[model samples]
Target: MIVRPSLTRSIPFWILLVASLAVTVAGAAIVATTLPAMIAGLDDQTATGGLVYGGQSWITIGSGLLAAGLVGLFVLLALAAARSFLPVVKPTADAIEADDAETGDDTVLVRTDEVVPARDEVPAAR
Candidate 1:
């Protein structure tokens, strides 16, 4: 019997792909809709724009790094999933011959020396 491995058949691969895509889209949306408003609000509240700009720069860098890390994790998961679907090679002729020699008999032998007592022969508990 021969079995083939498939990535599409694996549940983990699809799960990871979906989760990564969701995180990427949601993160991007949140940043896009909120970053500008937050920066503007901070600038208005603060006496100097420099502090707000610096904070925004750090936030942008941190978000970029987080996105990159998520992407890297997704790629790693994909690679691991792909590794499971690698092709299987057939056994060599020598290996087949050795296996056949090791188990040449098709019939199995059994021994029946022990016997069990009938239900009527057992004593009831007090």
Candidate 2:
């Protein structure tokens, strides 16, 4: 797909933040300019005030969306980086062989799903 410049991945959070601020300021300016005229003509001060409030509300919504998008972008970037840096992470057989040879750990067989003995079966703690 198109991996365009994103906030967290490429464009950076600070740029997105600046964009949010600019959009918010522009929206606020539009509301501020319209409110006085709305008050004079419509004679509804509350509605006039609500114009700015609505602008702010929508700005907050846009910021939240931007943040979410950026977070996802960053996660993808991180996953890609990790995949590249740590490809095919298989355990080396030589290490296991060395451990078995040196420590006689072959027969120990530390099973991951081994059941633990109950308190009665276990030796009492001094």
Q: Which prediction has the highest TM-score against the true structure?
A: 1
Candidate 1 lDDT over 1-126, as tens digits, reads: 222234666687777767776666666665675577666777688535655565577567657755965885679577876665554434444545555566764222222233333223567799
Relative to the true structure, candidate 1 reaches a TM of 0.42
lDDT (tens digit, per residue) of candidate 2 on 12-63: 5556555655655565555565545555545554555465666456556655
Q: Residue 104 in candidate 1 has what lDDT?
A: 68
Model 1 clashing-pair count: 0
